[model samples]
Each structure stands twice: as C-alpha cells, then as structure tokens.
Target chain A: MNETQAETQTEIALDVPWNVVVHNDPVNLMSYVTMVFRRVFGFSKEKAEQHMMEVHQKGRSVVWSGGRERAELYVQQLHGYLLLATMERAI
Target chain B: MNIERDAEGGFIFSDVEASLAAMFRAIPSAADPEGSKAALDRLFPDPAAGKEAGLSAEWADYVRPELREGFENASTTVEADLEPLNAGEDGWTIPRDHIDAWLNTLNQARLVLASRYEVDEADMNRTAPYPPESERTLAVSQIHVYGLLQECLLQNLE
Candidate 1:
C-alpha cells in the first residue's frame, strides 16, 4: 500500500466511533456496578455513580465511546465483571 | 464477611462462613460454560441489543471464546486465593493484583444466585426485608450477604 493510502486507512480507523454500553440487570448490585464502572473506565465515584444511576433508571448507559478496538476491550472487561456490556458502531 | 486492606499490600477477609469459602472455591467448577447457560447469559450477554441481527451474531462469534476464557481464568485465580482459608478461623488474604479476580468471582456468584432465585431489579433492594416463609428467602439472604462482601471489597479499594 502507498504511504498516503496507509495514512488514510489509519485516519479512517481513528475516526470510527464505537460505543461501549452497559445494561441494567436485576442481579448486579448497584454498588458493585458502580465500582466496575470506576475500575474499568477510571471514572470517579461521582461519575461512576452517575452512570450507574443511568443504567438503573434507564435500563442502559453508554459508558464509553471510542475506537472499535478500545470499545471491544472495555466491553470484554465489563463482561469479566459480569456486567451486561456491548459495543456497537456509534450512530 | 469482612475485608480489610493489609499492611502487606493485599486485602484480608474475615468472618467468612465455611460454606461461603467453599462456595467461592466451587465457582470455577460450578461455572460450566455449557451447563450454566442461563446464568452465563446473564453474566456475558450478547452486545447487539437486537439492533442488528447480523452484527450481534458477528460480535458473539468474535467475543464468546475470549469471554469464556476470561471467566475460567478469573474463577481459577479467585479459587486459589480462597483455597487456603479455614473458613471460620483463618482469614484469606487476597494479593492486590488478584483483587479483581475476587471481585469478578463474587459478582459471578451473585449472578448465579440471581438466576436461581429469579431475581429482578425489583428484588435488588438491599433494605427490603424478605418474608420468612417466602421460597426466595434463602437465596435472597445469600444475595444480600454477597452484596455486603462485594461492597467491602469496593470500599477498601476506594
């Protein structure tokens, strides 16, 4: 591939936005969910609690948005914490 | 169960029931990917949210194996940490790095409990008192206990 072609590919990859979402479930405790959000996203307690509350009240929350690779990693980490997480191309 | 961060840079857990320790140890064995399908679904759900059927299938195909492997590794690490505890007497000290495994394992156990009891968002109020004769009494009680343990771990980390 030409240098310009590679650069264009990289730029497109960087521009693609994927959202990492966590959905509310009956089983996960609020505190535990908040902690997972903080641990995975480095969200402060207040920010984490805010997202947690959103999940609780609204049934889901978009916890993070970024490149597809990072979104996949975050969703995987959330699964490891047993939180319902998914990544999708951001609309 | 009570958990406190130790001077040695890990966390120590006390007041744990023997059965609870056994339960922690059993997580790796009990979390059979094939056998515990319902519980696993709750733990590692499909990410697609039904928006695009093809995308959800593709995502599951890409992510399921990794998620399964992750659950196995986390459960084993947590079991190893809890293996030495004598339950009622000896406390278990979780090394700092393995704390995530502990937290994940506890969360998985709660998922199993929730699955068993058919627990839903309405059932998660920690403050609600369970009816003594309710069939859900035992499972509900256990869920609260695990929640307390998880809270202790989270609080100490903060």
Candidate 2:
C-alpha cells in the first residue's frame, strides 16, 4: 500500500513472463497463420511452419513467451490481423 | 529463399514473397461478389495508373496495374447491402458462414502472396525498421482488409 511497496510490486510483476497464444480457428487458413507467426514474431519459415502445424493439430500454441507488456502487444497485433489470439501467464 | 544484404548491410529478400504475403493477408474477401467488386473499384480507382512521377522506383512498385484491376473486381463482388449506415441507424449484420468464408479467402491470398514472393513468415517479422513508404503501404492494406471484415460483420447482422 505504501509507495515503496507499490513500486516493488510493480517491478516484480514486470519481471514475470507472459505467454502469447494463438488459438486455432476454422476461419483462418494454415498458410495465413504461418505468415502471421513469421511477421509478428520474426520467426523463420521452418519455425513458423512448425508452429502452424502445432496450431493445426493441437488446436492452439503458445507462440511467444515474454514480458507481459510485449506479450500483450503481440496478442493485439495478431488480433489486428484477424487471428484468434490471446495471452496468459505461463505456468 | 536467398537473402542478400541491402546497401546498408541489412537483410533483404532476393525474392519478394514475404512482403507479398503480408499484403495478401490484408485484402478483403469477396462477399456478395458483385458488390465487393464495386467497392474495390471505388477504393483503388484505376488500372495502369502510375505512382506520382517523381516518387522513388521502390515506391512506384506499390502502384501496380493488377492493383487497380483487383480492386475493381473485389468491389463488384462484395455485397452492397452492407453499405455503411449512418450514426444511430442500425448496421448490417454479418453471418457466421460469411465471416468464415472471408477469413478463408484472406488465408488463401496470404498463401499465394507468400508462395509468389518466396518469403517465409519468419523473415517478414525479422525485417526491422521497414522503410517509411513500405510501412505506409502495409498500413493502408491492413485498413482495407479490416474494412472488408467489418462490412461482412455488418451484413450478417442485417
């Protein structure tokens, strides 16, 4: 509740990694999904293709895991491209 | 699949597939095919139109003959019943099937562009600090793609 405590909490929270996950949707094509992963995360073609396959077979995949702020931004960007995307804390 | 260094020593695609893929993802689907085709015409306007004469050659590439023709065709195919409604007026409703169809088309275009340009998805994200003109084109293309999605959603509501 004090300023020092609040500041400490903020720093701690900022250090936690958040996970960015893209959910499989019937609407988006596999190729488009792969391209989005490449474009948004700068993933290599092979890596992007792997993730795309995971999404297709597994129904979803955690594409990126990083700071919450960055994760949120990635999720938003993916959504902007009409991908079904979300973010959550990595367990 | 070959990468070369640009004048600044940064990476550049020998093939344009990645950039093309990005653009394709940003195009709207043809719904009510005729209406979509018409809308595209109004947006892109003319074929064989040149980019402003003085612009750099790279910038000029953004304005292509196919762009005008594609828009015209897209506009005609999109549904006209979904035209933008005024404030306080009820908007058109989009059907779930239509949304799915549009998304499918967007995905197909993405594939075509990527294959045509021979750029992988990861390469697209890795390209940092895009030139201003290229960035502008991507932004504009995204807006158009989103607009089509919005239109589909509106139509389904009607």
List the candidates' TM-scores in order. 0.77, 0.40
What candidate 1 gets wrong by more than 4 Å, as runs, is: A1-16, B1-4, B14-34, B86-90, B126-136
* Per-candidate count of clashing residue pairs (backbone under 3 Å): 0, 37
Which residue pairs overlap in candidate 1's backbone?
none
Candidate 1 is scored at a TM of: 0.77
Best-fitting candidate, scored by DockQ: 1
Tens digits of per-residue lDDT for model 2 on B1-158?
34343444332322334444343323543221233443333222221123223322422255433334443444333233234221222333333434433443443343233333333434344446545666444543443454444443334332
lDDT (10s digit) by residue, model 2, range A37-79 = 8878999989999999998789888898988667756755664
Q: Model 1's CAPRI class?
A: medium
Candidate 2 chain B minimal-lDDT segment of 10 residues: B43-52
lDDT of 1 at B6: 76
Off by over 4 Å in 2: B1-158
Compute the interface RMSD for candidate 2. Answer: 16.2
Write one digit per residue (lDDT tens) for candidate 1, span B1-158: 77677786688878776767755555555444455667767766877668758756876787777877777788888767766673445567789898777777777777876776678767776566778877577666666666776777777776
